[model samples]
Target: MKKLVLSSLIGLCGLSLSAQNVLIGEGSLLRGRGYCEPSISINPRNPDNIVAGAVLDAVFYSTDGGESWIADTMVSSFGVWGDPVLITDTAGHHYYLHLSDPTGENWSSEEILDRIVIQKSTDGGQSWSNGTFTGMAHPKDQDKHWAIVDTSTNAIYITWTQFDDYGSENPEDESNILFSKSLDGGETWSEAIQVNTIPGNCLDNDSTTEGAVPAVGPDGTIYVSWGNRGNLYFSKSTDAGESWTEDKVIAQQPGGWDIDVPGVQRANGMPVTICDRKGRLYVNWVDDREGNYDVWVMHSDDGGENWTDPIRVNDDTGSADQFFTWMCVDPVTNILYAVFYDRRGLEGNHTHVYQARSTDQGESWTNIRITEESFRTNPLVFFGDYNHISAYGGRVRPIWTRIQGLKMGVWTSLWEESRYEGEKD
Candidate 1:
């Protein structure tokens, strides 16, 4: 739980905003490995209680908002791998979900990625249960999963990509989005069902059916969106996970989801779905439509039926790339906040983390750089796939990864709603 404090004052659009940046975890960097792919969640009951996760089983908990954090390694009977997704329910219960490696042999064992394992933490992420699992179709692989808790019914829903054969170049191998729900907390889960109509290849690339993030509408309707074959597809399950509507193309991802960003081993433009309190469904992702990657978002007022035109979120005039975007809407204030890696005023692989605040839904954005300073990244080091943000009440915590001196570290900003006066750019 060692703390690395880096505080700064950033000037955005002639407005000076101050934020305290706290480093959650950091470790020595390997050629293609280090701590990255961070996810965060805030408990609505107690905004001070925050929890986040990074790659390879790193768990961080912050009781004093984002000012301080305690880091620990998560373990389970079904071994904890990467792709950590953390979510908190209305009752303040936290759920940590990730891929499993039962044999502890990683890629060497066939049991790796056999299913998605979920661990429940009752005491605000202080400790977790041994864990339960879903989507356990043996011989097939489960990856890239996200979950949402229905506050109305206290039921937890999860969506993920299921591959017939991971990394297989065979044309016959395919990947599809699968979903499951838990009624009694995380004690047990229903049988996993395929929700996507169209399937993609098992290569885990642009054509692969990945990034199926779930969102719950105000009226309890479950909605999900993903990228496949250069199209952003949306689907809904009104009657819970028992049935789902036919996949509808919501947006055309010109450059697909697999983005080629300099100074990173791999990057993704996968879509992230979230619904505000007013039932407005918002989906955020990154794509190279203008020859350079940028964050784009679309909102649907009438569930997943009709959507507004694509709205650029970065608000930068230059063509510097912005990728790996994640969004979340505050239930109390309904303010939409998105975080991503930005290279707007820097050269080459120097990257900075930015946060875009939308007080008027997804219509416009006020972009502000949250990072104290830009860090230069090397393409030889794996930068992970995505960054995450969680907003509860008026508290906003944006989690991201940065490379300094060839070492990787996960960091968060102590950003609050009071810092911004809703001044539109």
Candidate 2:
């Protein structure tokens, strides 16, 4: 058989592709997502278990891995953001999802009403129970989302930003991160604690807002990062949010026009992170450092003592076409695989999914465009392994939204295991 490379674009699908078979598609056993974009994740504990959530307020679960699907309960009273955070423990026994009201819906009455929230799903995404955190809701029209993790102590530490709409007053300061901890499931959270504020003095206050990404290392060291006042920063706590270290700059983009358009505003979405088994910390974000929003990665080898220079991850690093990126590592191989949306096609502006592999510990990569099927343009990719291997073996999947008619339909692609991790170093 001849190896064919898809060079031409499809009239309906847009990009050109050579080979591959569709796994779970929209019309397949997995219900179609025509209402709003949906997000998917495999339970960390059960390889046969998969979960996905939609904007309509329901999280779907798949017991036979991702081969088939079923709708899980919508949880009791929790709102959902664009992309919900999913995590399964090392044993794959415990599974969880962290969500909040972008519109402040399904919020608690006693608290701020429309505030941050955490939900638990121990039965592999079948059903969920609500757990309360320090009750601090967002102000009117303020969106609340969270960064949550199950730490080495078996405790769940969650963090989120609470602030007002754009163009607000500094006296209002409008933005700050709140922290909480749960020792016994989502039953109880520590006192409502404010971790750090997005320190900025924008006289314009003209469309300025940012959020934080807090991830807990295996050692229970909590690391938080966000952008504010035209800069990027990080804060840490070894004592589980009880106290914190002084804030430090991880990296910040240049100001003025560079901050506009596809700017790396912390408000874009949740920051993606991964930690090697050796306790090394890796954080990657999108910024307009190149005068256009591009993916930049910074690593802390010595547990945040210091970070390496910013390294661009997109294959088309020549342009600021990369954004909305996410990464997951194969614990067995320790290889880093990242996928992100890019707009470089000559036909028109589209968010095609591009993938890259880092073999030398984030030093070098083989960047490749994975979306050879999207034609409507703007194809987004979510890279994760159901089998949990770094070599891209087992089940390699990417979830994308396909725009059809007046509706944007949710679609997914799962390459056969034989086709997994084929690219070499």
Candidate 3:
């Protein structure tokens, strides 16, 4: 693998621009337990305090605006398996959610993935509770869960995919999206309810319904979107999670959610939904509709009733692959930011991390390369599903996975919007 600094790329232009890269955790080759699929959240109350989580049971925290981090492992009675999702409430309380493995037997026991587990942290990510769970319908599997906090009421809402029998080829097995909420912090949760009208098979592929991410509108309305079959579906709850509208198709995902990228073990173009303070809803995903994988976004102003045409996010002119994309709308500034693995000017399996910023409500974008070096990946290694970005005020933190040889590590870049005020392409 070739290692090059960001400053080296900018030297040709006689300009200096760089974002500080911080490594949170690294994994060894033993049993292939390297960390990936990282999630991050910045405290709304204090931008300096941040928390992050990676696959399996790793947790990290930074108090000085992501300059340094403290890493630790998380435990729960229900068992922390994978698919880590982290979010912080308005009151600065952080929550870590993941799939459960009750018997610790992994795939050998049917008890694995019987439910979804959520643990709360009051004092940042230093410590966590044993965890409380929802969607505990045994004999079934719950996976691909994501959550968001309603700043108005401090309530937590989550959405995920449930399977009758995971990885089952039987035609009788099915898959659906489920919704749940916690009104009184993490102490209790509402009963999980079915939200998707059409069900998919249990194959966990393009036909399987997945990627139900929830976003809150300015008027307190809840909106969710997912990819099923070859279309992206949308649904909303005007009265919170108690009720939901019938599922509606918003866009066509030509290649579906399951995507093919070289040097990646497995990848998906799952939709990530977010809303700005002005009630403008945005859904971002990746697909190969143009003969190669690219990041795209669609926005709805009337709360999912109508949506704009798919807007390509990458600025490169040639065909290249961009996968594992994530987006975030700054609550204070409403500026849109997206992060993804980019192969714009590189050949073969070489990849670098890039972020796009849109200040005019997705009308146009400016791309910035945030990674200090590019790394090559091997398709045999198990690279996790997704990467995450969180922005509060002007502070932006993008977390991603990097593979060097046989070792994998989780990293974040200390990025602030003001740093590149006069930067040019």
Candidate 4:
């Protein structure tokens, strides 16, 4: 039997759940003082085999449906400098993608930030090859990348922000959304193609176009969305990224993607794009549209051509900050799940992890607190930019970073949806 914890944690709303939370990473091997920006993926072919990756150099995998995990260090010839993204192809091959740092330095030279590297592992992320790369332009920096594989064709599509000069304030320096793909497993990739029509300045602020996550529709159409200048923009390609439609402004991000939150060095509400199995599109992000920062979501049934108004995903009516959201949809069931940092029950800088589920599309939602305890966040440390979640076969895993006693760790809850049989939606 499982224990259920019920409480009024979500402001005036009572939250109840039976989540088996698990600590995935800790101790000396986690490296440095902090670990954030985690990525996780569930094998559609074998849901028991789940893989996860984290910033700097960390990879964790489980063969028994996350009952336990094996922590491993990730290394690549291109160098792993954070922004770890993991994905699996139709053939059960897992790939770890991150920004390249050839010299292991802090991107002191142009070549260090010249490419986005990807490493392949055939044996369920046990080992990874040296890796391949795309967008190897000199002096240009590639960051904040995400990938998706079309199970039907085994094609891998990746999208990211390509910077002319990372963190440059010069007017000549610019940033734009770029797309590339690999037709054959992970052997090679096509040349990088610019997907966005409007170029943003390279100030690394709200104006900078970043966070381009790609999703494939039922008919193989590619859809992407990103944040820029207090608004969310979207574009799509029908020919496997050969071309793209002109960008369209989808939603308003009132306070922009970057925001200020107490007890954190930096926080971003960048958009995460996902498409369900039926060709419906959904985009999720955080913003201070209300009195405080909250996770917001929008959906489109027709395609990327239209979108519904922003709906608050967090159930709290209190003025608390909720940021760093990442969303995923179960392809088989079409249920939507989002994970983010929540401060609804805290008095100050303390934070907890919360998840919002929408089974009737975006019409209704239920908020649940997944963390057993709250931890204090420190502004002196970098909390990273985003958290990740992956769900399939009713096995949902939400990965996030936390700080306690000045040490940083990453964790996930082995939340099996079967616990609440008739309570779904």
lDDT of each: 0.90, 0.53, 0.89, 0.85
lDDT of 3 by residue, 1-425 (tens): 12111111112133245467777778785666698999999998888999889998888888888877777888898999999999999889999999999888999998999999999999977789999999999899999999999999988999999999999999899999999999999889999999989998999999999999899987889989999999999999998888899989999998999998998989999999999999989999999888999999999888888999999888975788999999999999899999999998898999999989999888788888887668997788889889999998878999999997677888888777776664543
Worst 10 residues of 4 by lDDT: 3-12
> Which residue pairs collide, candidate 4?
none
Clashing pairs in 1: none
In TM-score terms, candidate 1 sits at 0.95
Residue-wise lDDT of candidate 1 within 1-425, one digit each (tens)? 44333223233333366566778878788544678989999999889999999998988887888677777889899999999999998789999999999999999999899999999999988889999999999899999999999989999999999999999999999999999999999899999999999999999898999989999998999999999999999999989879999999999998899988888889999999999999999999988888899999999999988999899999985789998899999889999999999999898888988999998998999898888788987887878888999998889999999888857888888777776554321
lDDT assessment of candidate 1: 0.90
Which window of 10 residues has the lowest lDDT sum in candidate 2?
382-391
**Cand. 2 Cα-lDDT:** 0.53
RMSD of 2: 7.7
TM-score of 2: 0.75
lDDT of 4: 0.85
lDDT of 2 by residue, 43-134 (tens): 54455676665444545566654545554435445544333445555444333444445345443432233445556667787667664534
Give the TM-score comparing model 4 with the true structure, all chains together: 0.94
Q: List, residue by residue over 155-197, the lDDT tens digit for candidate 4.
A: 9999999999888989888899999999999899999999999
Query: Which is the winner by lDDT between candidate 1 and candidate 2?
Result: 1
lDDT for model 3: 0.89
Per-residue error (Å), model 2, residue 81: 6.7
